[model samples]
Target: MSLSDKIKSNPSFKKIAHWLMIPTGQHRPRLWIRMIVNPFKHKRGKNSIIRYRTRLDVFPYNHFDLGERSVIEDFSTINNGVGDVFIGDRTIIGMGNVVIGPVKIGNDVMFAQNVAVSGLNHGYKDVTTPPSVQKVETAQITIGDNVWIGANSVITAGVTLGKHVIIGGGSVVTKSIPDYSVAVGNPAKVVKKYNFETNNWEKA
Candidate 1:
């Protein structure tokens, strides 16, 4: 099913979805409290689990819609402020990574360390309000099936990647990418396309 269809299936997600829903600015302390107390408050179903030392800041509880058998590793922060975020089954969110919302991650996906996925970009046009005080611009980020996001990569808002896409380490993705493509570089570009016959990445 399509992502929109899948999201629509759960009506409860619309009610209480936000990062930092409460006004508590001391994120670290609140996170520690959850860690010490109900670590599973961020988790959805019984099969989903967060590994040790995983530090997730306050996020919309319903925004992180997890399928069965998913694991978020240590030091991973999922802060959903913009919109809904959904993680598919058997996906692994690596350590020291940060994922913000309005992002949908697919099944069997793997994210290496220090990966940053953010869907809300602060508005800078208004000089009266500081960047943080200015109106927040919202966008959606979509990662397709069997995708692998490499270490230290940053995925910005309004980007949609297709199925089986591979993002190399330390790349910054500012735009959308097509399916089955191997993308790399600063402001990531498609360097090669997958060749089924040769079983490798060939020049596009």
Candidate 2:
């Protein structure tokens, strides 16, 4: 069975695991206890703050991959072993987001609420085979500098988001995006080019 199936099948074990993770003699405010109880064992980074109300489901981390000054806010779920997720400096993974890794996110990036960043997909090459029954394919997701991923967006595997790309809320980014474009909707499309009318961004 998959890891997810194992978690479902042994709810008691899961509860026990949470109970075991409680740090002794650490004074956390009552409001923040549940959120601080259990975090993925492999998660490590400098100054990575997961707030009081957040929930990271079963995520793993690469210790060498740093999350410098990053904030994973409340109600987010980072799922079990896909691979390592590297969040760069000054990144904000907002509330209610889910990230399954093998993803390298760049500096100053913001992922809004309910955003999903996944690095795995199901394969279905055989005509007679259903996609759900097929083996899973894995890839890496790379986000460039100064990108803004809006609320409720889903970024699939093997995709690279260029610098300064603004993905609108509720977008489904299946493919790669170019630099400085504003994309929106399911199967996100570039709707407008970034025009600097106020000398904020100069044309290249």
User: Quick one: best lDDT, which candidate?
Assistant: 1
lDDT of each: 0.78, 0.74
lDDT of 2 by residue, 3-106 (tens): 74686579897665444443434222232333452233444467878787765444222322447788888988664455677778888989999887778889
Q: What total of clashing residue pairs does each candidate reach?
A: 1, 0
Model 2, global lDDT = 0.74
Tens-place lDDT digits, model 1, residues 16-131: 22122443444333444455533454446558887877765544333557767888888888765457778999888888989888889999899999999999898999877799
Among these predictions, the greatest TM-score belongs to: 1
What TM-score against the true fold does each predicted structure earn?
0.78, 0.68
RMSD of 2: 8.7
lDDT for predicted candidate 1 compared with the true structure: 0.78
